[model samples]
Target chain A: MRTHSAIAEPGAIRWTLTAFAVAFLALFVALPVASVFLQAFEHGPGAYLAALTDPEALSAIRLTLVAAALSVPLNTVFGVTAAWLIAKYDFAGRGVLLTLIDLPFAVSPVIAGLIFVLLFGAHGLLGPLLSRHEVRVIFAVPGIVLATTFVTFPFVVREVLPILESQGSDQEEAAVTLGASGLTVFFRVTLPRIKWGLLYGVILCNARAMGEFGAVSVVSGHIRGETNTMPLHVEILYNEYNFVGAFAVASLLALLALATLLAKRLLGDGSHGGQGQPGASQEAR
Target chain B: MSVTVRNLTKRFTASAGSPRAPAVADASFEAPDGAITTLLGPSGSGKTTVLRAIAGLEQPDSGTILLDGVDCTAIPARRRGVGFVFQGYALFAHMSVRDNIAFGLQVRKMPRKEIAERVDELLSLVQLEGLGARYPKQLSGGQQQRVAFARALATRPRVLLLDEPFGALDAQVRVELRSWLQRLHAQTHVTTLLVTHDQEEALELSQHVVLMRAGRIEQVGTPHDLYDHPSTPFVASFIGGATVLRGRVEGTRAAIGPLSVAAPDGALEGAGLQAFVRPHDVRIARATDQSAVSLGKIEKLVRVGGFVKVELRLPSGEAMTVQMAKTELDALGVAEGDRVLVDLLAAKVFVEDYSI
Candidate 1:
C-alpha cells in the first residue's frame, strides 16, 4: 500500500492560496455587504430603530412575513405529496411530471413573475374573468404571493425526493401488512421515516421564501405602504437616495436571514437524531 | 387457523433487460392448525414468495388462499387476520418498545387505557418490562426480535407467519431463540408457517417441513421421516449428509465398492444402481496379517466441532468421507498418506443416480 506523508502542505504555498481565495471572496461576496453594514451602523441605533418602526417599512415587513407564512405550509403539503407520488409508484408520465415540478427551478424568475401577469393582469388571458369578479391579482399582496410561490416551488421537492427514494418502500409495506390503514401508515410510519428530509426541504423553502425578490418585485406594483415587501422597500429607499435608511432595512433582513440559518441548524440537529437506520442516519449519509 | 394455499402462482414481469421469471409456480400446501409448518429452501427458491402470497403482499397469478376455511384470495393483508413477523424484525424504530408492541391495538382503534394495559402486558410477556421506554435501536437484536413478536401477537390473529425469524442473529442467539420459539408455539397453539433456508433450523423448529426446489414442493413430512425415509435422491442428499456410490444390481444383490450387498428385488440384473451410505455408517476395519490392507490412502482429515472427518481415496481413486471419533483416532491410526480399509454396513439403494 502506498503511504501518505502526514505533513501539512508548504506554509508559503498554502498561506498564499488561502489568502488568494479569501481575498477573492472578500472582494466578490463579503466586502460590499460588510460596507453596507458598516455604513448602516455608523449613524447609531436610533436611525436603525427609526427605519424599522416607519409605518411603510413595518407594513412591508409584515406583508413579506405573511406571504411567506401562507406559501410555506401550502408548498410543504404539495412538496411531500408530490414527492411521495414520484418516489413510490411507477405510473405513466412520471418522468414528465417530475420535470414539470422542477421546471420552476430552471425557469427565469422574471418570466415566472411575467407568467402570472400574463395570466392574471388586465388585458391578458383570463384577465376579463378575473376583473369581472373584482379579483385583484396584479398590484396586490396575492399577486406577490403567487410570484414568490412560483419562484420557490421546487426547493422542498428537490430536497425531499432523493431522501424518499433512498428510504425504500419496505417499511410502508411492513406497516400495511401489520394492519395499518393507508392513512395510518402514512402518518405513523412514512412521515416519521422522512421527517428530517421534509424538514430540511421546508427550511430551504423558508430560506428561499424570505430571500425571494425578483419575482415578487415585478408583480408587487410597489405601493409605498401597501404592497411593498421588505426587498421592494429596500430597492425603493436606495432609489430615492436614502442610503442610510436602505442599509438599515437591509440589516434587519440580514438578521432575519441569520435567524433562519440558526433555526435550520437547530431543527436539522433534532431531525437528524430522528432518522431510523444506523448507517443511513442523517449524521453520516 | 389452518392455511390452505391452492394452485398459487406468481410471475414477475421482466423489467428492462431482465428475463421474466416465475417467483412462485403453482405452489400448494396446507399448514394444519396449531402446528408449525416450515418452508425450507435456499435463497430465491420461492419460499418467501409463498409466505408473502399468503400474507397478501403479492397477488398470485391464479390461486386461492384459504385461512380457516374462509376464502381470503382477494382480501387485503390487514383484514386477512394473519400476523406476519418479517425478517429483520421490522420494528418501528421511532416508537418505544412498549408503544411498538401496542401499535396493532392502537391501529384497531382500541380503548386508550386498554391499549396501555396490553402494551404493559406484552412488554412483560417478551421479558422486556424495564425496557418499555427504550426505542428499538437501543435494544439488542434478540430483544428487538421479541418485541417484533409481541407486536405481531398483540392483535391475536388466527395464524402467524415468520419469514426467517432468526436468520439475522448470531449462531448462539439463533440456537437459543429456536427453542424459545418452540416453547412460544406450544403456549400459543396458533397455526404458524416459518420460512428458513437452514435445514437444522427447519428440522428443530417445525412439526412439518416442506422442502421446496425450483418453486415446487419436493417433500413435506416430519423431520424424522424426511431424515430416515427420504422419498427421492434430492430429499436424501438434502435432509441428511449421505453419499451415493454407483454399482450394478442382481436379483437380490448388488456389487458395490469392494463389497457385494443384498438389494431389493425390482432391481434388474446387469442394470446400474446407486447405494446411499451415511459417513457414520462406514466403519474402519483392521486388515488381517494374511490379507494386505485394502489400498486406500487418507487424502485429508478435517476436524469438525466434536467429530473428525477422514477423507479416503479408494483403490478406484474415488474419494469418500468417513467420520471417526476422536477417542477412536488412536486405534485407527489414521493419518495423511496412510492406507485404510472402510466397510459399509447398511446403505440405501436407488435404481438411478440423481445428484444435483
Candidate 2:
C-alpha cells in the first residue's frame, strides 16, 4: 500500500497565493514610493536640489530634526523607566499602568494633539497659568514636540518590555548575589541584554517623530518657518501648488524612513556584529 | 561560614484572593561550616524555597537566618555574601566567559589588574582556560554550568548555594559534574547548601541530608543515618528502593498476609505498621528450606547490569521484588512459574499513621 505525504497540495495553489502577495505589495507599497521619487526628479536634479535648499524647506528640515532630537531622548528615558517598572516587579494596578502606556497607540493622533492642546492651548486648561508665566506652548515648537512625544511614547516600552519579561529575574538576581548594586546590575547586566531592542525602539520612535503630520498639524498652527516639520512642510508646499518643491521635500522624509528601515535591518535583526539571540530579532520587530 | 535557617515559612497567594498553602512551612536546617548539606525532596517539597531564603533571594514570612552566628535575615542578597548557582546557569549571553567571571570583581571596584588576574585564575579553576573569549551560547551545557560556578565564586562569598546544579545535564555529564563539584567543594570549603531531588546525588555529595516533604522537613541527619535508620516511611521510600508491606502488629512481631516479620523497636501491640523492606533484603530460597516464612511463585526475572531482579507473587496474591547477584540467581536455578520460599531480612517497621 502507498502512503500519502504530508502537505501534498498541488503546486498551482501555492504559487497562486505567492503571486497574490507579490501583487498586493506592488500595488499598495512599492508603486506609491516609486511614484514619489519619480515625481520629485521630474523637474531635473538641479530643480530638485534648488527646491530642497529653499529657506523655508531648510528651516522645516532643521525643525523636524530638532523636534525629533528633543522628543526621542525624552521618550527613550521614559520608555526604559516604564518598561523596567512594569516588567521587573509586581505591583498594584499593573494592568492599568500597561493600558496607560499603550494609550497613545489606541488613541487617534489628532485626538492626542487635541488632548495636549486642551491642557496647554490658549483659553484651555492651564492656559491662564502658562500665560501668566509668559510661556508659549500652543502654536509653537514646544507644542509640536509635545504632540510628537505623545505619539511615540509607546514604541520603546513596547519593544523592551517583553524582552525584559522573557529574560526574567534570574540574571538580575545573580548579579545582585555577586555583590553588584542595583545601578551596577542595570548597567552591566540588564542594559546590555536589552540594548538591541532598545535601539530598535528608538529608531522607530525617531522616524515617527520626524514624519508625524496629523498631531503636529493640529498643534503647529502652520507657521511655515517656525513650527513646520518635514511632514507639515510637504503639506504646505503641496497646498501652494508647488508640486516639485513638495515632493522633493517629501523625498527627504522618505529618505529618513528608508534610513530608519536600513538601521533596523542592521541592528534590529541581530544579523550584524552582535551577540544578541536570533529570537531577539523578532522581539525587536 | 556556617549557615542556619530557623523556621522559614513562605506562602504564595493566587490572584483570585484565595490564600494558598505556604511553599515552606516552619522549615529549619543548618549547613555546617566547611561542609556540604543537601536539601533533598521531590518537586513542591519547598526545598528550593528554603535554599533561596538562606541565600536572601526570598523574603520569609517569618524566620531568622543566621550566618556564622550573626542574624542576617534582613540583609539584602547583595550584602549577604552568598553565591547562588541557578538551575538554568543564567550566564550572561552577551559577555565572554572572562568578562562574566570578572563581573563581581568589577562591581566591587577592584583594581583593573587585580580583576584580570582574578578572572584568569577562575577561568583556570573551572577548567575553561582557553574558552574565556567565547560567549556563553557557544559553549556546551556543562561548560556553561562551570562558567556560572566560576562567576558565583568570583566574589569569594562566605557561603555557596546551588539549586539543582546538575539538573539539566545528561546522566553521564551529571555524574561527571557531580564529582567535579565534590572536588571543588573540598578545595573551597565554603559552607555549601545544595537543593536537589535526586536521591543518589544527595546521598553521595552531602555530608548531611535534610529530607523535605510538602513544605516541611521530615528528617535531617548524616547520609548513613538517614539511609540505614529512616525515622519515617517517606524517608525510607524516598531514599532507596524499598517495597512497603502493610501489616498488623502482634506484640513485637508484625504479620503481613501469611508472613510474620520482626517489628522495629517501640512498635505498639495491636497496631497497624508498614514494613519497609529493600529489594536486596528480600531473600529467595527453595521451598524445602526450613527458614522460609512464605511460598511465592516466581513471576518475572530481569537481568539488570551485574544483578538479577526477581519478581514474585506470594500465595496471598501480594507482589514482592528480590534482587540478587547474577551468580546467586544461577545457583538458585529458578524459572518463571516455579514456587520458591521467601525470607524477609532487615525490614524496618513503622507505624502506618506516620506514612505519608
Enumerate residue pairs that collide in model 2. none
lDDT (10s digit) by residue, model 2, range B1-356 = 88888998999777655789999999888889989999999999999988888888899999899999999999999999899999999887768888889988888899999999998898888999999888787799999999999999999999999999999999999999999999998888888989999989999998899999999999999999888899888999888878888889887789887777887678777789888889999888877764455889999999999899899988777788889999999998888888898888778788766434
Q: In DockQ, how does model 1 score against the reference complex?
A: 0.39
What is candidate 2's lDDT per residue for A1-285, written digit by digit as tens? 556479765678889998999999999999999889988999899999999999999999999999999999999999999999999767788889899999999999999999989999988999999999999998998999999999999999998998999878898899989988989988988887788889989998999999898899999999978888989999989999998999999888999999999988877546344544532333444
Tell me the tens digit of each residue's lDDT in model 1 across B196-304.
9999999988879988887878888899988877877778878767777778887688777575567866776777887777788788765443255455677888888
Give the range where candidate 2 chain A is weakest over 10 consecutive residues by summed lDDT.
A275-284
Candidate 2 — which residues are off by over 4 angstroms?
A1-22, A269-285, B289-293, B353-356
Off by over 4 Å in 1: A1-36, A53-59, A114-143, A217-228, A271-285, B17-19, B244-277, B288-295, B345-356
Question: In terms of TM-score, how similar is model 1 to the real structure?
Answer: 0.86
Candidate 1 pairs with clashing backbones: none
For model 1, state the Cα shift of residue B301 in Å.
1.4
Q: Write the per-residue lDDT of candidate 1 for residues A86-198, one digit (tens) a residue.
A: 99877778889899898888988888888988999998898999999999998998998998888877878887788778767766776777789999998998787777677
Error of 2 at B112 (Å): 2.6
